[model samples]
Target: MAHHQHHNFEVDGVDDDEVPRNKCRTCLKQNTLTIATVVGVIMGAILGIILKSTKDKWSEREIMYIGYLGEVFLRMLKALILPLIISSLVSAIASLDLSLSRKIAFRAIAYYLTTTFAAVVLGIIMVVAIRPGVGHTEMATKQSEDTRNVTTVDTLLDLVRNMFPPNVMEACIFQTRTDLTSPSPNVTDVYKYNISFETVQNTNILGLVVVAAALGIAIAQLGEEARTMANFFHNLMSVSMKITSWVIFLSPVGIFFLVAAQVLQMDDIGSVMSRLGFYFGTVCLGLAVQGFIVLPLLYVALTRKNPFTFISNMGEAIATAFGTASSSATLPLTIRCLEDKNGVDRRVARFALPIGSTINMDGTALYEAVAAIFIAQVNNVPLDIGTLIAISITATAASIGAAGIPQAGVVTMVMVLETVGLPAKEVGLILAVDWLLDRFRTAINVMGDAFGAGIVYHRSLKELGLLEQSSEEEKFQVDKNNHIDETAQ
Candidate 1:
């Protein structure tokens, strides 16, 4: 196998330790921003605790304002998710030749499906191991007219149905980009991160993925005729990623504020931590293992590439997703990360990732699987192996049905509960504490996409000799390849 050059420039004459100083300096700024954001969360949580605990009546008004700041952050990030996916994907897949397209799709889909399956299994296992919901007392359930957004027997069927274009105008009419809606009269008390329709249980992200993939395959199959449109999308993906990279450099401020805000308000932080701690703990453990372990392993099995190199290149994209908490929003960054940072062939990264974004959800799928089983345990329902297997499949697809935002997993859990015939009301229990876990799951979902791209691209590059299969990473480096022109360098 051969290779292509990868570059990171430094100010001349700098010591090796001093080399990372520039990058390190930026990291320090990011770390500082992260600390500040965590402080903000702490302060806000404390303020909420104090206001609720000390006063005769808490100001709904103050909660509204504070919540709004979080909303603003979500909105800006959400605003970028859809276009980033749509444009980047169209461009990425379209530009590939048929030889590359097959390799890209084959490996990407394999990585996605396998890793997703593992994530959900892990989620279910961890939750069952800990039984976070078992023997747990709870706030009384909300009054139900049975009109709430719970799942139904028909929900999975409906989820598949919704992905296709019932009407071309639907995306715009429905506000496809952001998940949260503006607050108005009756919706005032709850968090405004609205994700579901009152009557519908599924959003059919799988349908959208199917459509995009069909289009990409068609374009690739058509050759020169499709080249113009393909190039247009490729360019779009490229530009979006450049923008994504730019956005990445600024994320420390956003993350810091977001985290700080969460931490600032701790009323019996200990008790709350103790109470919901397992839920958070399980989610984190699952995501960390899936994101860092399972997904990387999938890459190695599929493409035989070094996961560390893939991780190194994908840093900016992953960081952006962690901060933004939306894969669609991170699309630009993910595409850029695959092509620019990692040595993925352009065509493969474009085609697979966009499709993966809509359908391949390692993190959300895992959360859904775990949450459903946990809810079943709380309700004292028995889950056999068959049921667990069903859950693995349903949760995998349901993750695509779920939106990529706060509380998305809970909403998707509605579908999973229905699949296993659990009382949909149990979802409210999970919902009560889902916000914190949602962020971690979203990052897991993005990692799935990043790793999927890496695996597929690695396979493609290997076939083309764009990347060599080394006996070991220590034995090879990209600079040895002539693909990167030295004069152009």
Candidate 2:
């Protein structure tokens, strides 16, 4: 007989055994991300500096190829976006009981909105206190004349229109661009040639999610047919995740090229930093407060569990979020850790994580608030109390629709900026550091999703009389469970 010895480590009253062993594929992928992040940062910085210094010595072809490598990597990540989201959403919804679905969905969105609101408020306070954009007058002059000037009413209409695309297929397959001359133009030349002041935000991810979710819910209502569709979606999700694993393996190389290209494009990195350092610092500080302080406090308040244990278990998901700079791409891993490792209920995790990934923008909301105020400050636009409040509201709304991808906040930041009459083009000031900041924001976003999942799962168990329930409550839940079982059978 083989003998097994048990080993354990305890920290802060939580046993190490509470965390599942790290031999699983989730842990392996996370470790890969952690290593890739370190190696990629080192390689990116070194290669960026070298290429920037020797730019004149290299041929144009070589530089283009280097940039192309990074572009290809981004395309690879984008490739996973549709398939992963559709499959995951379908599988997550199909796995849940229909009645509990609404309850979980409401709780998840409520948690998401709460965290995002707090984040934006924190960001406003930090940027107001720090005043990051006070002295950078030169950056104000670098504006693109093409920035559209729309009224509040117009912006509201645009937002509504974008939320529901005319055709889900057009929304999914179409890629919106300001440059019509580029390949894969989705619209006619009228909007593409930059002749019209109107712009269409082509990546209607919210619309795609809405369509997929509707399909999933419909599939769930089909009873036995639901099982067939559920199996298909489950299989599709498995296949897509395998593809994601392959793509993630290339993260190190992708990060190096992306960062290097980012560096080479900058004429004077130091000058950009000196001007935007305060803005960047403020955003990071706000993110840290939200990720480390606010969200954990909420988690403890809800679950009465150790935040350290929760975060430790989430290490892989967080690492993957940072490396990919995407919550959507990291959704599979996040769901895995929450379900397989942390014991979050499948219903709660499946419902919360996917919805959270789509709309939960704690980090993005914080960044948008800071960026809007910073831009206003940089451009010498004084914001009154009323204007500040408006900015806050707009930031939250804009973040709801922000795509869970790298630098997605910047695109939506324009909406927030427009709310306060700031020059949308002044966003150029912070473009240099956006890539670096993106990783941090993505981490916070994923953490928020996990935290929401934890709270929802606990509440679900509580409702089932599994935790801290009276005898009457326990009996009530037992009857409810039997009823559900009979219905299922």
Candidate 3:
């Protein structure tokens, strides 16, 4: 069998040195997280422990002030989540060739659903096997008064209804707060509660995604008439990215206070650590299975390519995702790695990843399922097969709205909890470790995106009659052909 070399369309030189240095630096930078992030996390953990060990040195009022300021930084990150998803997705869609884009979109969605569903099932299995939340009764007892439950039937109905927003502005900017007790929720209570995506904040991200995608499709249909709209979204994406950069500069300071406050609030750091440690171990295990075992195997089976080579090629993108904890922010690097390093079609990467950043969140889906069930287990809420099935569905659906930014997993996990009669406030239980686990999930999410690009590019090649069959399959065919020719002769 002849081994054929794939050409990198993005780079003409065909030389090692011609490879981009920025991406090369990605691999080198792996051991070093963003300097500020490392400093902040380290200092925050130390300060939190010190404050915990000696309360006389730090006042609760001072901690509260620090936490309040830190929250402002979190809110800034949340504010960018929606704009980034919408603008990037809309711009990517509008800029694509509709016929090719539709094919790639279908494949991407199918692949995403398959992987996300698998991730959820894996999470459920892990939670059941490990039973990490079984003994954490205290955490469950602290459930907020706002905990609400809907029937399994209503849960499905609400998910579908919420996906299509009646008012896009309200959906993106303001979320509806439902008071389960009242037939008509009290007007004052509704007016008083303004939850964005964090801390009971409800920005209907799924609805926003639907609206953005629909607008993108509409703009694409307009052909030349849509130029201005397409350009507007492109520009908006640029502006949102710039804002994200400025916000990221403050992450170290914000993370320090956020971690310290969460730590200080825990009455028993030892107990908290034990429970969170189990949960963390479960999440990391799920991520490893999905990112390492499942996705790579899938790529090998689909493309007849060496999975190790694929990973090696995607190292820079993976590192970038880990360091930034933002798949959307890592888009430029992911695209370059796929095109220049892995020989993935530029069109496939362009179409698959922008949407994947918002929707194809295998890691987030798995985490949500694990978190929801973990919370339920701690609360002693028994989940039957029906309920677990509902959780799997709800987690997959809710994850469609997951923003490709750090800590967004915690926000979207609320949807899964609400579907299962758990309080959204339970999210605070895992908030302390979310920052750390976020890097893991973000890296997995970017891995999924890169895998999607590779698989889709291979499929496109086969469709165009360009891709070769595996060596064994080709050899068998050739042997059969030779036998047939000999008999005829």
lDDT of 2 by residue, 1-489 (tens): 122222222252364454565346556774666566557856876897898887445555666677676668667877877887778788878766677677767787788888989998999999999998888777744564446544444445555665676777778754333222323466532323332223354566777778778888898889696688789988998898788777766767776777676667666778777777888899999999999999999989988999878887887678667766788877877877788678887656766777788888889899989988988888889989999899888888878877787778887777787788766687777777887788889999999989998998887775534323565788999999999999999
**Residue-level lDDT tens digits of model 1 in 250-328:** 5555554554344333334566667667776777888888888877777777777688777756665565566556777
Worst 10 residues of 3 by lDDT: 190-199
The better-scoring model by lDDT among 1 and 3 is 3
- Model 3 accuracy (lDDT, Cα): 0.73
Q: Is candidate 1 or candidate 2 better by TM-score?
A: 2
What's the true lDDT of residue 156 in model 1? 60
Model 1 score (lDDT): 0.64
Summed over model 3, clashes come to 3
Residue-level lDDT tens digits of model 3 in 302-409:
989888888877775675566456776666656667877788765467567767776888888898999899889888899999999989998887677665666777
Candidates in order, TM-scores: namely 0.74, 0.80, 0.68
Residue 186 accuracy (lDDT) in model 2: 66
Give the TM-score (vs. native) of candidate 1.
Answer: 0.74
Candidates in order have lDDT scores of: 0.64, 0.76, 0.73
